[model samples]
Target chain A: LAKTTQPISMDSYEGQEVNITCSHNNIATNDYITWYQQFPSQGPRFIIQGYKTKVTNEVASLFIPADRKSSTLSLPRVSLSDTAVYYCLVAKGSNYQLIWGAGTKLIIKP
Target chain B: SQTIHQWPATLVQPVGSPLSLECTVEGTSNPNLYWYRQAAGRGLQLLFYSVGIGQISSEVPQNLSASRPQDRQFILSSKKLLLSDSGFYLCAWSSRTEGPYNEQFFGPGTRLTVL
Candidate 1:
């Protein structure tokens, strides 16, 4: 499993966009970058996933650089309800194997 | 549409007592099941995974054991609980698909407190 590095915490205000970046320098060719959002006392939910370039979903967007060593999750117009921990995960295929990082605590202030 | 179910939502057990947590998947068949534990203020730790019935792979060496008795049913058990075992347990399932399109869906989670 590849290790991921992310900021321990971040602060943002409502209606502002938040972008959290993760670095996986040793990412393998088969590895895919995935992001998950976890609220207090709730299980992490899948936000977005990407292998290269950019991928957009109803909730967020994922941007992967050409090197595939790093990726960013962009949340548009974040709200107070978005205050939660965001985890960056790396995995391969349909296997149940996943490596989870400490996650970036995003505090969406009013 | 797929849904994962786990119970009991919260458990408070005494140390040295036996523990059993169950997880089941619905609307999907032959799904790959996983057991993960999230310590307070920490990240998730992969405990065990199963690809099929009677096949389990453990990622970490611990007192807990996992079993898959049916296609969509998985269980995490311990003969005797420990204080270190107290945490939030989550069960997840993913379809057997090729490539990197497989995204796991998680259950509500079970909070176990060992006293």
Candidate 2:
């Protein structure tokens, strides 16, 4: 398991773009970067995942530098509904447990 | 098309009472099941995980235990509840076929309050 560090919280307004970065300096070669979103009183939902470079989905985009030391989650045209905690994790294949940090509390203001 | 279910959306039990929380998954077989606990204002803590029936791995040593009786059914149990056990419990499943790169699907979760 690779330890991740992220901002404790972030604030943004509607229609704005929000970017959260996570640092995993000790990331291993087999480790992949994954992101999850968690709303209040609900289970965390998968947002995006990537091994390197960039990967985009219907919801968000993940960008990883060549060094793979850190990654960023970019959300476009955010709304109030986007308010949630964002978790960035680096994990190897199936057997190892995931180490979750406190996560970034993203508050999308009206 | 896969879905996960957790029972007793909310529970309140007195100290020293027995506790059982069940989680079941549909549309998937041989899935890896996990139990996680989140304290108020904290991140998730992995408690236990099972890759197959009759096999379980515990990440932390504490008062709780887990069981996997069926391929997609996982259970979290404790013989006697303690106040410290009060927290939000979540159940998650991932496809073993996807190997280590699989993304986990989480259930709605169970909120337990031990007084």
Candidate 3:
């Protein structure tokens, strides 16, 4: 399990792009970066995952640098409903243990 | 699509009372199941995980215990509840085929308040 650090909270307005960065300085070679979004009283939902470089889905994009020491979760055209807590995790390929941090609270203001 | 179900969306238990929370997954087999607890305004804490029937791993040493009676059914139990146990309990499942990188599907969650 790799420890991750992220912003405690962030603020953004509607129709804006929001980028949340996570730092995992001691990331392992077998580890991959994953991001999850959790709404109030709900389970965290998977946002995006990547090994290196970039990976994009309909919801968000994950940008990983060559060093893989950090990753960024980018959400485009955010809306008020995008307000949630974002978690970044680094874990080995087959490892079942997921290390969780306090996460970043993103508030999308109207 | 796979779906995870957790019962008793909300529960209020007294201290020293027995506790049982059930989680079941549908449309999937041999999936990895996980039990997590979230204190108010805090991150999720992993309590237990099961890879197969009759197999369970405890992450933190606590009064709570977990059991996997069937492939898709995972249960969390405690002989006596504590006020510390009051929190939001979540159940998650991920595909074994995709390993750890697989996206975890989470249940709506169970809100337990121990008094």
Tens-digit lDDT track of model 3 for A1-110: 36889999999999999999999987878877889999999999998889999999999999999999889999999999999999997766645557666799999999
Kindly list the per-residue Cα lDDT of model 1 for residues B44-80, writing each as its tens digit.
8989988889999999999999999999999999999
Provide the lDDT at A37 for model 1: 89
* Deviation from native of the Cα of residue A42 in model 2, angstroms: 0.9
Provide the DockQ value for model 2: 0.72
Rank order (by TM-score, best first): 3, 2, 1
**Candidate models: Cα lDDT each:** 0.90, 0.91, 0.91
Instruction: Give interface RMSD, per candidate.
Output: 2.4, 1.3, 1.3
Docking quality category of candidate 3 according to DockQ thresholds: medium
Q: Please give the lDDT score for candidate 1.
A: 0.90
Cand. 1 TM to true fold: 0.95
lDDT of 3 at B69: 94
Q: What ordering of candidates by DockQ runs from best to worst?
A: 3, 2, 1
In model 3, residue pairs whose N, Cα or C atoms come closer than 3 Å (at least 3 residues apart or on different chains), thus clashing, are none
- Which residue pairs does candidate 2 place in steric collision? A93-B100, A94-B100
Q: Candidate 1, B104: how far from true, in Å? A: 0.9
Q: Model 1, retained fraction of real contacts?
A: 0.66
